[model samples]
Target: MSKVVMYVSGFCPYCAMAEKLLRARGVAEIEKIRIDLQPEQRAEMMQRTGQRTVPQIYIGQTHVGGYDDLSKLDRQGELAKLLEDL
Candidate 1:
């Protein structure tokens, strides 16, 4: 499996849901970067994605966007191929 990295806050439901979906898809060992815990990470996330969203996801080096974007990719059958490439 490829690496799953997510920038999330502690109180985001969308982040939790995204994580659950990834886990369900057999993505173990998710590397979570808590924006709330480290203020610098928030800036990093924003710099990377140009968005201050709570759930900024990255599957390997691919920027998977937020929770809804991630789910959309999965529903559209693009996620598996992306992961396979990763």
Candidate 2:
């Protein structure tokens, strides 16, 4: 399985949902970077993804965007492929 990293805040519903979905898809571990706790990480996330949003996800080195984008990938049957690409 590929490494999954998510930039999230404490009170983000979409972050929780994204975690749940990834878990359901057999992702055993998610490396969650809590931007709420470390404010500097938010800047890093924005620099890395070029967006200011919670739940900026990455599957391996590929930026997966947010929960909606993740769901779209799953719905299109490409998420499994991405996850297996490690």
Candidate 3:
């Protein structure tokens, strides 16, 4: 629905989980930035999201935090609405 970007590491379980959830929610394209491969991407992610987490997710211009936060929004049934806005 929107442009999805995530900062991920190869071995991050949360990254995997977040990716699964997004796919389940009908996100077709995800721009994944591997912070482990590109260390400078971590700096860019931190500066953009103000977090150093493995799965820093952005839906359009909205910072959706990490896996847990994404789950919370999904559970609350707010994620679809957010995606619609995107």
Most accurate candidate by TM-score = 2
Candidate 2 positional error at 43, Å? 0.5
User: Whole-model Cα lDDT per candidate?
Assistant: 0.89, 0.95, 0.90
Ranking by lDDT: 2, 3, 1
User: Lowest summed-lDDT stretch of 10 residues in model 1?
Assistant: 77-86
Indicate which candidate wins on lDDT: 2
lDDT of 2 by residue, 1-86 (tens): 23999999999999999999999999998999999999999999999999999899999999999999999999999999999995
lDDT of 2 at 10: 95
CA RMSD of each candidate after superposition: 1.8, 1.7, 1.7
> In model 3, which regions exceed 4 Å deviation?
none
What's the lDDT for residue 60 in model 1?
A: 87
**Model 2 regions lying over 4 Å from their true place:** none
Candidate 1 local Cα displacement, residue 49, angstroms: 0.9
Pairs of residues at least 3 apart in sequence or in different chains that clash in candidate 2:
none
Higher-scoring candidate on lDDT, 1 or 3:
3
